[model samples]
Target: MDGSSPAAAAVIERVLAFLDSKTVAACKTVNRTWYTLATIQSARNIDCHILQLSLRIAHYKRKGLLKSARSLTVDVSFVDGYLSPAAYERRVRDAAAMLQSSLMPVSHLKLHASSAHAALTDGEIHHGTTAIGLLTRALPSLASLDLSDCPAPLLTASRGECVASLGRLCRLKWLSLGSNDMSSATALRRMVRANVRTLVKLDGRGDVTDPTMQLLMDAPQLRQLDASGSGISDDCLLALVRKRGASLRELILSDCVRLTRHSIAQLTPKLLPQLASLDLYNVPVTTDAYQSLFNAQTHWPYLRDLKLKAAIHHASSRQESRATDDILESIGRNCPRLVSLRLFGCYGSTDSGLSAVLGNLGYLRELVVMHHPVDPLIDEEHSSSEAGGSQSGSSNTPTAAAPAANGPSSSLSSDADVWAGIPSLPSNGLPQHSSSARRAVLPLPSTAPSSPRPADAASGASSRQRIFTSGALRNGVRSQRFNLLNLDMTYDSECAAHLAKLSHLHTLCGRMITRHAKSLIEAQFPKCRMMVWNID
Candidate 1:
């Protein structure tokens, strides 16, 4: 058989595919071609736990083949005594020696260890010293270095020397240090200052303060920043936004509680234009402030994902009502490209506010309004009735609605079932009526028992008092609580019925009986693709 023929080439390809599944040693003896292909595939990506890699290093050294590795990942987790102080030092030194001697041209080096590792503790200076020495010597050509979940306190405590060592990683473009115990912001500042020019991503959770953020802003090359669960305040966020980092594409500020309307007003207009995604979890921003930010128009045109988490705060009086209204209105008119919106705890937003915002964003694909006050009122009422009926004599009846020291409702239930029986109105049925467009007026289930007499009411006047005062039984009453409560129940049933008519909606998630209502809708409108109920 001629070796250069097409048939021979096809045979070689088939043999190579089979060899890909076998181990290097098994493939080596198959043929010279198999040996070359197996070795190349094996050298392309090397991932080893610290212990395994240490053992492998010793074996490779013994075999005089350590220099063949091109990519290496060392994960030093606290498993099977491998992360003990002595073992950690030994592994680090061995890995470093191997890298220095044979892997100097390594392009990708990932150093991942759990926070519990002994060598990652500030108190154990010897372990940190050895680990830092190893990292400094082993990672010269690293294009990606992820020191994620390494004990930050230990790294910070060894600040001066560790920072100097980290500076030696001149080619590092991606870095993540999320969820560490780095108490001193100064250490992080030093690290960023030393390597900002080459760094493209920084995950400095719990250690990024305003000053450190300022230093990062100076790094013109930074494109992605994850400050989630960090102690960063609005001041730090403002500083970050104000600084022109043209390369930035994603910014995650989840759980940064100090962000307020004032900070959002200052930052949104500046950062929105450059950012492709922004996560503002539990950040307090008034409607007017959001409107002002959206008014800039230039900011959100390029935004693909804008998450406004818990966008509302409890207002003290009616004076702030207009501000909240303006915010919802602005969001609806602006942000047309939003794909995901999670308003999990924004109590100030009602169905009207949500409709205002969501109605305009035709591109929304993933929406999570769980636990927020934005659920249909009918759904909320059905939930309350079910809960109240279940625990009329027990203390748990109102447990779901109890407010904190500050007055805010606890959860929002879906009222989709309330509209279960309503006739299918045309899509354009409520073009003039904003609420009517999505409105469903389902018939109340015959199964719903009549409203039970207030258990505590003893007389006619007392019964009226009991009915009104029942709002207090559940939680602190809003000014229009009773009226809202009744409407919530009514609307919930109505909406559930109407939802059955929407044949185009693929998925719908809501509360208790809403699921039943969704099934009924699916039965009526078989074209409706998916229905999920009782989803919070």
Candidate 2:
């Protein structure tokens, strides 16, 4: 349909709304009317640093595209292409000049360092400050600014012009300076106090201490605060929450290790009534903290997304495992509106405990359950002892109980607990098992050699070498799917069959799905995509 006609234009608008940016860009070439509409929409969000930003801006300006641009991302990391620090600074200055010359009424500007860029050194930090000053001076209407992962120090700008530009940014309601070295709270306090009344979202995930937090005491309009890894304790956190609690909607305190049970227990629903998303990953909390935060009496009805993944391979593994159990149970009792739950290193949690929480949160769309490290992997001496112990008990290890590969029953678990339902093959083409005792000989990694270095021997006999499995995938979301059924490390034929029964499932990611299990999964769910990686 051509965009010239009113009815056809309305239909095309609706269709364009549903399509992604690339599709919309492609649709622009269909006709003149479409071209005009697409150009306007495309210029709304511009990635100025994706290619030669100066050339792109010049081309867009020639085509009258720069005027429509509203949200611009000025990535300064590309300056790394230059060999010397002088070359990098010159390029940054040139970029700033080009941006200054452009007339793109950009309201949202994100000056970020690319992920590949290393942490900013003192020299680079100075250059970064100059670049920020240049860009902010050019964009007078800037309302939202994200300097996240930028190498600049938190408190002081390298140049006075940079600090003056920040103070002049009165329209900035959203400011994100995550990962900056804010060693001087004095400098941060001055800048924040200038725009404290209008700032809504403040992300200070840097070297923020109690002094840094105290700067936020007057920011009553703040709605979202991410002070992750800021090295702040309960006293500072509680103080910030007390001042900004009524308006704060999202709080991310990930990796704040100094926060103990005494401080965490005080995080009642009353403190953050409007809180919607809470992330406490790697924050060590005791059982009492979990109980107090998510008890029957405590309730955060608006809370939807919660991530409490523990920092595995730590000294407090046992305590953290127990804390996980208590937290999961409390989630079942309190957080009824929970949409996503991630529990890493929850080794002590049983199938029953997980099932209980799942049953309660029916609207849950994402569940990440990475159980604690296997018993053998965590302790070197224990692994060595187990290796020796297994050799001694090789005769007693149930080798005979392992079913024959040729037998049809061998492919299917005899136990009912292995599968949820069905006596034989279900419509989904999966066999249901009733028992948990189904046995299989796992292909474990070989043990380390007896002779090892002194360091290796002291750490553990097994520390000399790491066990390499045939297949294992690195952690992270590998792909996007319409229906995400289950993502876990429990890879086996029985678990594959059980997962196959999930009728709505479209994607399954695991460390290792054996060839047999992969084939079974394919047979049961023809449309389902399986991503398996070998374990290390």
Candidate 3:
């Protein structure tokens, strides 16, 4: 062991690299060489919040770890009311000193003070501003600077020192000053202009407006941009898109309520060939623009992940055409290599559209369509109750007979249990539902007409006489297969059966199916994970 070869030492070093921070930290005590190597690998990305900034600074200065570290994250918001004023000030000074001292030029630095009390006084803001200024000024080689969620009043109190320091970082690539109090478009433009060639990602989600859009246009190398929750208008967004669309790979414009069809009209596959991931949550576009987005000729070879959750019409009175179905069909046609898809709150999509889309995309790994429209046939009970105030007059129904079979007291409890997420269980933890309650929830038809009805009549037939039945969910596993089966859509017994039949189904989510259907699906595909909602 004393005369170990260089190969063995290399092997040991590689092995230790795979281990976690604590293990590598522990291994440092084994030998000097191991200590040096472990420090270089793990200490480079220090979380000052976890280790405590005071301790990390002392360790860094003493052990010469700061020189090797490339990234550092300091969270000093934890120093709150527990510490005395004097002690808190001292901690702040020490943290500030560490940031100010350039023992090593850090490339990436994230200083988070958001968790600090919302009632941060003027004095506290000034102190924070001074600290941020010191840190930004110290790291000239800093490529990625995330000073997000800093108390705005504090940044404003610094007399533009923090903003001025940011403006000097010529090598900055990814900058996130989002959720801050400052709204000086001049100062923001200066920062963007300083690193126009290098800036790749900018998150101005807080106070970014039309003015900042001009500076964004200068950043030709920008790839991923997030302007969510901003007041940027269609003109600004369009300008940014036309300027940076070619280089942009990922774009998140969620909750930019002002964005209209004109803003997204230029985002065709031909224009943004490199764009892969797009999130347009709550960004309203017109019917024509929506259709143009997924045209037959539109093709994004690398486009894989897309999120259109709650991307509804901005104007309630507009009566926009339902494009959810067309969008899904287009995604299947255009983005053939698509992997992850999320359609949360897509009210336009129906059961047929969903089935058709799934049938087309065999390579889908993650599918999440929460709040999918319920099938009119399967969710008959809900529709019936809505149509007529509770069918109490129908004495033949199990719901009416429930009070007679069990006492009136038990009937109310049973009815309460019928509500999703609530179950009437005994001491044993198993639910106790009466036969009448079960029959009421899923009633079976007493009789059926022998003769087949006309096409017109059959198409318009009501679900009142529809019979409820259960069988093995895996009866058609080979026909309609999928990789990730998440039936979180509204309850459709037929759909649940179809999902259960997928042999490759790995994850089942949602509360659409009944207990009986759940049991069959779980039993057949025991390996598949079921993500149950707590309030289902």
User: Best candidate per TM-score, number?
Assistant: 3
> lDDT tens string, model 2, 1-536?
77779888777766766677898899888998897777777777778552356777888888888888878886655455455877666666676678778867888988776555545555656665666677788887677888765655522654535676776776678887776665544445555777787888877775567876787788778888887887898888899888878778998888888877777778778988989999887777656677788776887888888877544333333444354445666787688777767665454454445655655665666665544222222334644664685555544543332222233422332221111122122124323223221111122223312223322121332221222222221111222222443333445555555555554556655434567777777887787765443321
How good is model 3 by TM-score?
Answer: 0.70
Ranking by lDDT: 2, 3, 1
Deviation in Å, model 3, residue 229 alpha carbon:
1.1
Per-residue C-alpha lDDT of model 1 across residues 313-361, encoded as one tens digit per residue: 4443222323343465566566666665544433344445555654566
- Predictions: Cα RMSD each: 12.5, 11.9, 8.8
Q: Give the Cα RMSD of candidate 3.
A: 8.8
**Which structure is stronger by TM-score: 2 or 3?**
3
Which candidate would rank higher by lDDT, 1 or 3?
3
lDDT of each: 0.51, 0.61, 0.60
Give TM-scores for every candidate, taking all chains together and pairing residue i with residue i: 0.62, 0.69, 0.70
